[model samples]
Target: MIEIRRSDERGHANHGWLDSYHSFSFADYYDPEHMHFGPLRVINEDRIAGGQGFGTHGHRDMEIVTYVLDGALAHRDSMGNGSTIRHGDVQRMSAGTGVMHSEFNASEHEPVHLLQIWVLPQRAGDQPGYEEKRFDDADKRGRLRIVASPDGRDGSVTIHSDASIYAALIDGAEQAALPLQAGRRAYVHVARGALTVNGEALAAGDAAMIVDAAAVTLEQGRDAEVLVFDLGALNG
Candidate 1:
């Protein structure tokens, strides 16, 4: 079964400096019926104007990830981690017990487009951590490149959760596929461009909750960037 969430149906907020779209319940965008799917908690598409950003924020027991789509994002935290995440970069922070962090546009002219994601950790108060990595363009072109995983396999960032995140770039004639087990589920997010998931067409900002499928296919599409989550069950 596949449940589709049209882009326009999501909660949207347009701050002068920060334009955001919430895929699940976030801040004032609460929707009890769309709180979350599997272990994925939040998917916020954010665009921060130059010289602006999020001030120090606190979080606990969540596996947070930031994927920079365009421009650059500067980050700093109480954990003594400070850096700039640019396009093709993936950043992960494990707020096991608690952590404080801030994000800002790294450029003085260009705005930063990014996705801030949250996934429930497997256990509370395990340990605090941070990691960042860059994936080759070839790795994501025409295929899903695993960028985050529970075991940190293949040089990907480690997340304290029983799930994996992959990114793909599909253009004309390029495609990819993922196979799933009986109890697993998937979340597909379209960052930009147009594509088809299995047989359903989706455009930028659209998403799908998939289950009970033996395998899924993503057809290469014009200017399309996609994120896929192979998620495990959450006890809640």
Candidate 2:
């Protein structure tokens, strides 16, 4: 079965310099029915105005991943990791034990757009860590590239979670597919443009939760960039 979450149905918040849309319950946007899926916790599409950003904050036992779609995001953390993440960059930060970090738009005149994702870790009290990689358009064009995984296989960033994240860039008639394992589920998130996932149309900010799906397909895209997550069953 496939369940669709329309872009307009998400929770929204605007704070002068920051505009954000939450795919699940976040901050002040609480939805009991849309809390989370499996081990997937948060998906926040954020746009930060020039010279603005999130102040230093703390997190624990969360596998945090950030994907920049436009502009750049400057990041600094308590673990002494500092970097500028731009388009095509995937960053993973393990907030095990505990950690404090801050993120800011690296431009003074241009706003930065990005998706911040959080997944529950497979184990608690692990050491804090960070990793980042650039997945060029050529690597994702007409295909899904594994960008994050439990063991960092295929050069993906390690997340210490029973999940793998795939990134894709599709245009026109381009297509791609990922075979799902038994008992696993899938989550497709459209970052920009439009895409048809297994015959269901998804626009920017839209998402689909797929259960008992043997395979997930992407086709008939219109300049689309999407992220697909293969996740293990939720723990009770």
Candidate 3:
């Protein structure tokens, strides 16, 4: 079964300095029906004003992944990790017991657009950890490139969750496919441009929640950039 979630159907919030769209129930945007998809708990598309961003905050028992689409994001965490991530960079932080972090736009004049994802950890109470990696456009062009996974396969950032995340950049005549094992599920999110997923048309910000499927096919892309999540049990 595959269900399409339109871009406008997501919950939206704007705080002058930040504009965000939540794919799942988050903060004040509660939706009982859209709480989560498998172990994927949150997908927030955010645009932060230049020089403004989230202050020091705490999280626990969650695997947080940050993907910057445009501009740069400066990050600092309790683990003493501090750096700036631009487009093509993926950052993962496992807030096992607890961790404090802050993220701000690296530029003083350019806003930063990004996606912040939260995956429920497979097991709680592990020690906190952090990892970052860069996947060039050439690496993702016309294919689904693994960016985050439980085992950190292919140099992807590691996450303490039973899920694998893939990124892709496709244009006309380019296509990709990811075969799924029995009982596995998939969530496809279009980060930019338009594309067709398993015969379903999707625009930027759109997503496809798939289950009991044999594979996820992406094609007929119009300068599309997408992320696919291969998930485990639904009760994460």
Candidate 4:
């Protein structure tokens, strides 16, 4: 089955310096019907203005992944991990026991656009860890690039959960396909441009949830970037 999360249906928050869209129930946006999906807890599309950012905050027992689409994000955490993430960069932080961190735009003029994802960890209090990698356009063009997985396969960042995240940059009639395991589900998020998933078109900020699906397909309609999540069981 396939369900669409229309861009307009997402929760919107515009604070002058920060404009964000929440795919699922988050912060002050509460929609019981759109609370979450499987083990995928949150998907927030954020655009921070120049010289602005999220203040220091805390999280625990969640697989937090950050995907930068434009500009640069400076990250600092209680674990002493600090870095500047930019376009083509992916960062994963497992807030097992607990972790405090902050992310701010590293640019003085350009806004930082990114997707912040949270996946429920399989085990609690496992241990906190962090990893980041750069996956360029050439790597994702016409294909679904596995940017994060449980084992860090193919050099992708490792997450302590039964989930995998794939990214694709499609254009010029190019396409990609991802085989779905039986009993598993997938979530496709369109970051920019337009594309068709299994023949259904998706625009920027739109998302499609697939469960009991045989496979996920991406066919280019125009230049676009997409993110796919293969997730396991959900809380019952």
Candidate 5:
């Protein structure tokens, strides 16, 4: 089954300094039907104003992944990790037990656009951890590159979850495909530009939830950059 979720169908919130779209129920944007997909709990596309961002916050039993798309993002965590991540960089924080963190735009003049994802851990109460890696455009051009996974395979950051995240950059005549195993599911999100996923057209902010499918294919893209989540079967 393939279900297309339009860009405008997501829950939106704007707080002057921040504009965000939630792919699943989050904060004040509640949707019983869109609570989650498998272990993938949250996918928030956010744009933060220059020099403004989220203050110290707390999270537990969740694997948080940050992907910067446009500008830079400064991050500080209870794990004593502090750094700035720009485009093509992926940051993963396992808030096992508990953790405090803050994120702000690294630039005073340029807004930062990014995607914040939360995945449920395979087992709760594990030790907290952090990891960051960079996947240059050349690494993903015309192909899917694993960015985050349970095993950290292919130079991808490790996540304490039963899911794998893939990134791709494709243009005209370029394509990529990911084969799905039985009982596995896939969620494809277009970060920017336009593309065709498994024959379904998608634009920036749009997503395709797939289940019981053989594979996910991307083609006929127009400067498209996308993220794909290979997830386990839905949990009750």
Candidate 6:
């Protein structure tokens, strides 16, 4: 089964300092039927106001991944890690035991736009860690590039989960496909611009939840940047 979730259907919240859209139930946005997909818990598309950002917050037992789209995000964590992540940068933080972290727009005049992703780890209470990597736009222009995986394979960031996340940037005549093994599932998220996923049109912030499928295909894109998650079944 393949299901499409439109951008307009997502839950939205707007504060003076931040505007966000939640793909699943998060904080005050609760939807019983849209709680989660397998171990994928949260996908929050956020735009932070200039000079304002998330204050130090605590998290535990979750694998968090941050993907920036516009501007730069300054990150500081309890693990003594500090950096500025810009476009095409992927940052992964394992809040295994517990961790406190904060993110702000590095620029004083421009807002930062990004996606905050959460995936459940295979087991709980492991050691906390951090990893970040940059993928050139050329690498993902016409094909899927492995950005995060279970073992950090192919230079991807390591996440303690039975899942693999791939990213792609596509334009006219550029296409890509990811084969899926039986019983596995896939989720395609269009981060920005418009694209065609498995022959279906998708706009920015749209997503496709696919199950019992052989593969996920991308084609006929118009300046599109997308992320595809190859997920293991729940509790597998």
lDDT of each: 0.93, 0.96, 0.97, 0.93, 0.96, 0.95
Error of 4 at 171 (Å): 1.2
TM-score of each: 0.98, 0.99, 0.99, 0.98, 0.99, 0.98
Query: TM-score for model 4?
Result: 0.98
Residue pairs that clash (backbone atoms under 3 angstroms), model 5: none
Specify the poorest-scoring 10-residue window by lDDT in model 4: 227-236
| lDDT head-to-head 4 vs 6, winner | 6
Q: Which pairs of residues have clashing backbones in candidate 3?
A: none
lDDT of 5 by residue, 1-236 (tens): 99999999999999999999999999999999999999999999999999999999999999999999999999999999999999999999999999999999999989999999999999999999999999999999999999999999989999988899999998999989999999999999999999999999999999999999999999999999999999996574
Point out where model 5 deviates above 4 Å: none
Candidate 5 positional error at 197, Å: 0.5
What would the per-residue lDDT of candidate 2 be over residues 34-88, giving only the tens digit for each residue? 8889899999999999999999999999999999999999999999999999998
Worst 10 residues of 2 by lDDT: 227-236
> Residue 220 error for model 2, in Å?
0.4
Clash number for each model: 0, 0, 0, 0, 0, 0
Tens-digit lDDT track for model 3 on 42-115? 99999999999999999999999999999999999999999999999999999999999999999999999999
lDDT of 4 by residue, 118-155 (tens): 99888899889999999989999999999999999999
Model 3 off-target regions past 4 Å? none
Q: In model 1, what lDDT does residue 133 have? A: 95
Residue-by-residue lDDT tens digits, candidate 6, 1-236: 78999999999999978999999999999998888888898999999988999899999999999999999999999999999999999999999999999999998889999999999999999999999999989979999999999999999999999889999999999999999999899999999989999889999999999999899999999999999999997753
